[model samples]
Target: MDNQVRVAVADDHPVIRMGIEATLDDISFIDRIGSVADSTQLVALLDTQPCDVLVTDYAMPGGQYGDGMELIAFVRHRYPDLRIVVLTSMEKLALIRGLMTHGINAVLSKADDMSHLRAAIQATRTGRRYYSPRIANLLKALPATGSARLSQRESEVIALYVGGDSINTIAEKLQRSKQTISTQKVTAMRKLGIETDADLFKYAIELGLTRKKPLSD
Candidate 1:
């Protein structure tokens, strides 16, 4: 294949990894370099391997290098030229915004069809931003939580929480005190008119807050 786009996939689930590989198999221009099960291995591969695009799951547990935002940040810093396509189930606008702010090339939801992945990969390989249609709709539909919009810090707090981080974890990651993190969470929830954690999750989903989880095996 001439000018083939080499792609590496990082996903914990064997099925999802294989599915991505299989999807790219039909595209002659995309060469599947291989797949890794965690962010640690993905980073190692990125150091030793040459790839034009990376398709990685948002959350892969059991890696010392961490997952989600941390790993994304690491990759962006170390491999500035590599195009990143994040595969996630989370619909959180704040989370997506955060990832975009960090310069991720593309984001595709697991719920969307494989065609979306194909488009994302193609667009990203060419240095374009690609967001799944579902994601785009969610972004367009985002509304103010209450009488006032959420502050950047408040949105960051809720985004981390929705991504499965605990209050302490969020505080540690954000370099804020636990009380401050908790207060931000509460404030964000109140602004969204959410009284309970469960309701908060639902509200987040309603507002396109995507839950970051490993693809099902």
Candidate 2:
């Protein structure tokens, strides 16, 4: 077993937190020194006893770009030595590119295998960079889909929609009525030649809106 490496985890869902912690428990190299649900708490903890590596959710409560970007910016400005790897259900290449431009140490999908996550964490901790195969493949494939145009709002709604969030939940989160969210989703789907939620979800994965969810019982 490797020496315990100070680690921090941030995710919105309790189940996700549990899963991450459980995985780390199996790896002696990870100590899981801290955990938080949102960006605010994550930032606060870092200000006091920042861990060797920060694993954060891509998006968080309140719409202030509280995603990994905010925390990444803080680390860049205040704690330049800190390393960060964004673990997210989001597949958007835009967010990945944004993180890269902001000095994020690495980006990994929650859907990736545990080996990939471990490798990324270890690599980033040593000042090396690692982007998962999904991210690298997405970046390479982004240019091929030039004809599909989706507005920013559509993109946001679709991401939530594909990430297993109900339409009502998305509407509530976006501060819009269910009808509006439904209409926009239908319009976006039609424009994209999507017929079912499965198709919509597939397009989202293809467009890098959300990472593919693991199939498990």
Candidate 3:
């Protein structure tokens, strides 16, 4: 195999994918093998031109609206050489764990770190597991099992908010808007049966979502 790595990027949003392309453009060794919007184009590209690595977004339309997992599974079985990395905003460990269980090469979130994206692609090319720093730290801090486990996205929001960052800060970090973050926080609180800031902070720690240090003298 050559030293230069071939990469295929699949995402529904044009702006983000364009940003990703620009980011990869700086890397001398990465060859932009293919770039496609939506899952249909990806399927067509995979059928005609195979890429060394497949970087895609979860919860996107492939077979239909929000059926990315099916396509991934199909690719895993049909094309064994295709190294798959789920590059998306979905931070739920459940979704990450599910995709990884199906033999994905790597699972990365758009929020925690972008530097890891390049590293993950390289790692997957060599047939190894590539979990981002946030994921590795998450696993180190939180267990996946038990009802205490919160979705990765939920934890992300809680971590920022509980850590004293405002909604706008969280928004900028996650590449989302303040309204979206506000709405999600309220929704997640309801789902977790929390009603106040104190309760939410307590829940975040109990779920191993954040590390809120106790006040010291």
Q: Considering every candidate listed, which one attains the maximal TM-score?
A: 1
Choose 1 or 2, whichever is better by lDDT: 1
Residue 43, model 2: lDDT of: 73
Error of 2 at 132 (Å): 2.1
- Candidate 2, 1-217: lDDT as tens digits: 5566788888888988888778777887787888888777777777787478877777667533355555557656776777777887787655565576577768887777656768888988887888888876766664433225667788788878877788888998999999999988876665454568876665555344566774443
User: Which scores better on lDDT, 1 or 3?
Assistant: 1
CA lDDT of each prediction against the hidden true structure:
0.80, 0.72, 0.71
**Residue 20 lDDT (model 3):** 78
User: What's the C-alpha lDDT at position 146 in model 1?
Assistant: 41
Q: On lDDT, who's better, 2 or 3? A: 2
lDDT of 3 at 44: 80
Query: For residues 1-217, what per-residue lDDT tens digits would candidate 3 score against the true structure?
Result: 6777778888878887887788777788888878888777787887788578888877567444234566777777767778888876755544554465578758877775566778888888778888887666554554233224446887678778877778988999999989989987876665554568787765455334456685433
Residues 9-77, model 1: lDDT tens digits = 999999988888888888888888889999778888888989989999987877867788878878888
Q: Indicate the residue-level lDDT of 201 in model 3.
A: 68
In model 3, the worst 10-residue window by lDDT is 141-150
Could you tell me every candidate's TM-score relative to the true structure? 0.67, 0.60, 0.62
